[model samples]
Target chain A: MNRKGKLWIIILLDIVLGLVFFKALIGASEELSWVYIEKGGIRPDDILSYLDRKDYGTVAIMARSYRIGSKVRDEDEELYLMGEYADLLFYERIFAEDGQTEEAADFEKRRGEIRGVIPEYESVLDDMDQGIEKGLHGVTSDE
Target chain B: MKCPNCGAEVELLDEVCPYCGAVNKESAAHRAEMKHYKERSKNAKEKACGIISENVALIVSSVVLVLLVIGIVAATYVEKNAFMFSHWAARSESLQKSAEYAGILRQYLDSGDYAAFLAFENAHVIPAYEEGYTEFEKISGMATNYVAAMNSIENVVLFGEGAKHYSVDTDISSCQRSIANFFYTYERALTDMEGDPHYGKLLDMKGKMDVALRIYLGLDEEKREEYLESSEGRQKAYLEEVLALE
Candidate 1:
């Protein structure tokens, strides 16, 4: 092969390997985050309002459980990911609203991207509720 | 007609037939042929030995590969089943707790201490439900962690149907669904009772409670005992299995 062709082959290999490594890293981070949450990393404020915080820890965990249980497909997975992403952006919004310049600009640019996916997440949640209802029916049917 | 030293046609007059001068020419030719055959045989034996020596590494490698495959399969089975067994332990523990609380409520009703029963219902029973609800959430959270870990482990661990243990996934999901339903039903009943202090909400709550208790009680005394006993055993065995793997 000519020098240019060899260079192209090397570049292609590099890109493939890079993607594989990045994916692995993402998978690891997600796993670690989940483990942390399960082991009591979730707080009441994560899911419930203070006035209704009779069982805040439980509510928070249940919310996450519903989110996870509702996930059944690649699109659902993406929606879950985007929900987490939106949470980060929402935090940025908090800071941005406090007049952090770079965060303000980035928040303005990206908040809409997260906002766009909220309806889809809500739809996924509806599907999950339906699934639970179906399950309940099944249990009752056995009786 | 032949001389001893060399084959000769003249029997008595000549000592040798001198085609090529040698004594006992027939025997000498036989010896020469035998020596040639021995040299060739030695060369063939050495070649065979060389081939066998060269293949030693290849043979060892093939055996190692087969053993490695078996080890991987065993590890996958153990890991997936261990996870499932851990979930089973958690579920059993939760069920036992629910059953215990239900038993107490049943006892209260049977004893006809309506005031005490109501107080218990308000103070302890409702809080227990809240705890159970939260516990289920934690279990589901762990399952989410499992799912994520499964994804990462799949990249490293080949032959993993760990990700496809859909039965355990369904089991946990079903538990959450049941908990949610019970919480909603029971909570609504309580709310109605608070609003009206009537028998209707009381009956509704009791009905729901009865259904739950019956399911747990239906296992018969012996089976329930066995399940309770086996849960501990399974947990211990599961831990040992995990340690063995490590």
Candidate 2:
């Protein structure tokens, strides 16, 4: 092949490698971010700062959902969603309502409804207990 | 071309500079010379391509190696935190409920209203405490297993390979300790109440319970007569005696 042809091929190959490298880096970063979020590493203060800045809304939500959902039960998608919703609304109510107002009353009513629908605190504890039991068995089997 | 030593133009075919007596090293046929330089340039470009293509595999391998390293790091991070995260989340959920229950008991304890306290104990506090104690027992049992699981994981994996030094031991032990402390505190409260001069209030609670039970059972005069003949009536008669002492 001609020199120009070979050079073009090399350039094309380099571009592909660069793209792969970047994609891998991004994927790794996103994975780690989720891990951090799941571990309760993202504090309320971390998100409150973004709320203050009025930026990274999506980021804040992602962090909040993972942080709260972890408490609900990671394997149960339904419970996780419900927990996330409850958490978000709890903060929303705090930020949006003033005392002795209709809005506050409405928020309380909604809060009660959410609490009613979500699994009871006792059940959540039971699920955690069961999960830990299973984990222990898994570890035993692995050993 | 210009003469090497003098400002004079010469024909491309000239082998020597007629004006300066300088040998015309550049006197090769102009078309041929151009062709030669173009060919050399082509050779250089090909050499460049050769070098790039030769190292292409190496470059790709290096990139892949880096990616592998990154993947391992991400995997290690997730592995380390995933279990601990769930562990802590469970602990937090349990702790929140336990704290709330403890707070309620504390409030009642602080009120110092003997009648109200007796009523609440009969109606809510005692049952809730029993339920809580049972739940804590189950929780502590599971926590023991969880600690074992965590230790198992720690044993197999290299140090620092997973979540950064999770003291699963400390975490689970603390939970167990809290449950123990809670149970002890409640037991101590009951003991103190029994020993206090206010023990009469505790006895009076039985009479309150009989009344509450009668009301709850909707005992009309006829049913009341039937109940008075039953085992529950016997218990109530005993409670009446205690209530008389109070």
Best by lDDT: 2
- DockQ of all models, two decimals each: 0.02, 0.03
Candidate 2 on B28-69: residue-level lDDT in tens? 667578789999999999999999788776666566666666
Model 1, position B45, has a per-residue lDDT of: 99
**lDDT by residue for model 1 over B1-246, one digit each (tens)?**
455554555333223355545444435555677789999999999999897686665555555555555555554454435434444444455455765655554554443222223333332323333553432232222223222322221111111111222233333334333433444444554554454323343443344333322232222334333433454445334323321211
Q: What local lDDT does model 1 show for residue A26?
A: 58
Query: Candidate 1: which stretches are off by over 4 Å?
Result: A1-77, A122-143, B1-246
Listed for each candidate, the true contacts retained, as a fraction, are 0.00, 0.01
- For all predicted structures, in order, the TM-scores are 0.21, 0.25
Most TM-score-accurate candidate: 2
Candidate 1, residue B178: how far the Cα is off, in Å = 35
Question: What docking tier does model 2 reach?
Answer: incorrect
Off by over 4 Å in 2: A1-104, A119-143, B1-7, B10-246
